[model samples]
Target chain A: MFGKVVIYGVGLIGGSFALALKHKHLVREVVGVGRNPHAIARALQLGIIDSMASTPEEAMRDADLVLIAAPVAQTESILAAILPHLEPQTVVTDAGSTKSDVVAAARAALGAHVAQFVPGHPIAGREKNGPEAAIPDLYVGKKAVLTPLPENAEHHVERVAQAWAACGAIIHQLSPQEHDRVFAAVSHLPHLLAYALVDDIAHKPHADLLFQYAASGFRDFTRIAGSSPEMWRDISLANQEALLGELDAYLAQLTTLRGLLAARDGAALNSVYANAQQARQRWIEAIEAAEAPPPPPQETSE
Target chain B: MFGKVVIYGVGLIGGSFALALKHKHLVREVVGVGRNPHAIARALQLGIIDSMASTPEEAMRDADLVLIAAPVAQTESILAAILPHLEPQTVVTDAGSTKSDVVAAARAALGAHVAQFVPGHPIAGREKNGPEAAIPDLYVGKKAVLTPLPENAEHHVERVAQAWAACGAIIHQLSPQEHDRVFAAVSHLPHLLAYALVDDIAHKPHADLLFQYAASGFRDFTRIAGSSPEMWRDISLANQEALLGELDAYLAQLTTLRGLLAARDGAALNSVYANAQQARQRWIEAIEAAEAPPPPPQETSE
Candidate 1:
């Protein structure tokens, strides 16, 4: 699908994309660019990329696509460094979690070539980081949301969409603002809450005892709290407005529940719990149904 | 170890305990008691009990041990119903999540026979309920907390500990207040947060989109929200003071995080996330170490 693809900041998401592209034969050559020479060398050794480059200029020499797969906070600097080296026809895109900041960074760095950039976020990752954590099928069965701006060329958006499709990702299109709002509520807010809860518990006087007695429920709820601190901090700040809105909404709900508890209102508490339980069950059923294979053809009756 | 063991309100915890006792050959006979006749019948059919009784009085006949594994709200009623039938030698205990309330209920109902009761909580369960969800190894390698009162006989507490030990549980002793306070911080608070988060998102204007975009992180964070609403509601009310305190503490922490976010204090945010990530990692390592089998005997060169 492409002659050569260059990926910046070859870590978990970036390296995974390179492997997925190679495994699917979507690109003739995968080139990894990173400041860490050792990580780039490791990516090459791990077969995550066909070659490695210390500079984007060398990597994008003959590239048909450029993917800025770095952290959101680093996207601007990466774009500034790579924009001058990019070919006019090279369709540039990113896999940043926060889209608005990336879009703004593209506009500031790409100049006339802003029409080539597409902002995207693939909703897949693990707690582990680095190139060694990369997998060829990481994007399979996951959603990749694209927020293309009005300045972006239609052909560029189409090319990026096809690239993600080749990686086995389902694509969804939305405005930058909408993407930020939705993700802040569903993804970012929960992560912040989990982190806060764990921190609070750890600082308590009986933290050791509390952790000792914690079971599966506590483990699952706080699993996201173990995520990369730097990555989450960047996300929390980049999407501050939407995330703060979500946190406020969640707090209001919790306060209402506290009021009900103080009033000893069993019926209200039961209703709230029932509502959440039923909603979660429905969500789980939907996910299961989506993942289930199609039914086999029925045998004919003679 | 036991002649006849009677389990009241046979469900996941109760049925699992029965199976564990039977598997260990610790009890000669097991009897099931519940208000739901059909559930009792199902338990019997599933071999969760040797016999099914219509009332605790019939089940407690010739019983050496009785386990009240009902909801906290129902514990009082179960105690009231079974108090008149209990023998002074019968070692009675409960498997309720909250301890103080169950202890109080036993005192109110058992009167002079209160010394026979031991309050306990097995820190193991699944989202599924009823006898169908019961498994013999559910309590294996899990923590079983026993909160015994001063009014209870020492022998009764020792018997309860022995029973749980036979089930492969590591028993931890604590005061009722300490147990409630610790659990409120770790278990109850997380469950409430999950429920509130799910409920809040479900009521939003873009709920469908939010759920669709939610990936593994959100799913794990909200898994506990799918628990039995009636069970959680009863627990919330039963341990009202402790849970309320936890909710308040959590809210205060969140509010402080909000302040940091509003000010865009990247350093403070990073510190919070890093603290949580480190603490969670330590806790996970501790659990793995506890659950891991002892290393094979070191080679001896004589």
Candidate 2:
């Protein structure tokens, strides 16, 4: 699908894309760009990249695609750096968690070449990070969202979609605004809550004892708290408005829950829990149905 | 350990206790008592109980041990029902999630015979419920906390501990007050938060779309919300004061987090996330080390 690809910040998201493309013979070469020479060297040693690009100019030469998979804070700088080197034919995209911020950054940096840029977020995240954590099938069966710009050519959007498809991702598209709002409620809010929970528990006087008693439920509930701090910080800031909106909504929900508990209203409390339980049960069933393999064709009863 | 063992409310917790005891040969006869005749008959059919007791009178006749594994709200009534049939040698214990409430219930119902009542909470909850969900090994390697009262005999507490130990649980003791407070922070608070989150998302106008996008992180974060609503509702009320305290503390934490987001302090945000990440990482390590089989005896290479 691609002859050569340049990926900035070749960590889990970027490296995984590289491997997925290569494994399917979709991309001939993967050139990794990073400020840290040590990390660049390690990615090369790990065989996640075909070569190291010391500069965007070197990375973009003969490259058909450029993917900025760095933290959201770095997207602007990476876009600016690549702008000077981007070829007319190169279709640029990103794997940023937040789309509105990345869209703004690309518009400001790419100028006339903004049409070449396509914004995407592959809704696949793990607590683990860095190059070694990348897997070839990381995007398989995951949602890869694309928020295309008005200036972008139809062919460029198609090119980005095809690349993700090659990685076995299911593609969906939405406007930048809707993407941020939806993710703010579902993804970003959960991450912040998880982080807040862990921070709160960790700071208590008997934190050691509290943690000692935190069993499987706590482990699962707070697993996202173990994600890369710098990356999440960037995301939390970049998507601040939407995220804060979500926080307020969640706070309101909790306040209502508190009231029920304070009043000792067992019926109301049970109703809330039962509603949540039914919704979650439906979700689990949907997931299971999707994951179950199709049954074999039945024979004719001649 | 004794001839007759009567268990009120033969659901997951109660049924599992019966199977665990019978599996280990710690008890000779297990008598099931329930308001629902079908459930009692099912327990007997499952071989979880040696016989079904239609009433507390029948259940408590010559019973050496009585375990109230019903909902916290029902504990008092069950205690009262069994009190009329209590034998001087019988040891009574409960498996409520909250300790202080159970202690109060025992005090009210058992009166002068409260010395026989030992309050315990097995931190072995699953999202599933009912007699069908019972498992013999559910409490194995889990913490079974006993909150012995001042009125209780030491041997009575020991007998309660021995029963849980026979079920493969590691027993710990705490004052009822301390147990409720700690659990309010670690266990109950998480359950409320999980329930609140799911309820919030499930109520949105675009709830279907939102749920479609909800991924693995959301799955783990909301898993506890799938728990039995009736059971959790009772727990929330029983542990009301302590749970409200934890909820308030959590709200304050969220307020601080909101302030950070409003200010967009990237460094501060990163620090909080990093602290939480480190604490959670430490917790995961501790749990793993405990779950891991003990290292093979160190080599004595001469």
Inter-residue clash pairs, candidate 2: B1-B26
Query: Which candidate leads the pack in DockQ?
Result: 1
- Error (Å) of candidate 1 at residue B291 is 1.8
Clashing pairs for predicted structure model 1, backbone only: none
How far off is residue B77 in model 1, in Å?
Answer: 1.2
lDDT of 1 by residue, B19-56 (tens): 99999888999998887888888999999998987777
Q: How accurate is candidate 2 locally (lDDT)?
A: 0.90
> Candidate 2 residues B228-271, lDDT tens each?
88889999999999999999999999999999999988888888
lDDT of 1 at A255: 94
lDDT of 2 at A52: 92
Question: For residue A176, what is the lDDT in candidate 1?
Answer: 92
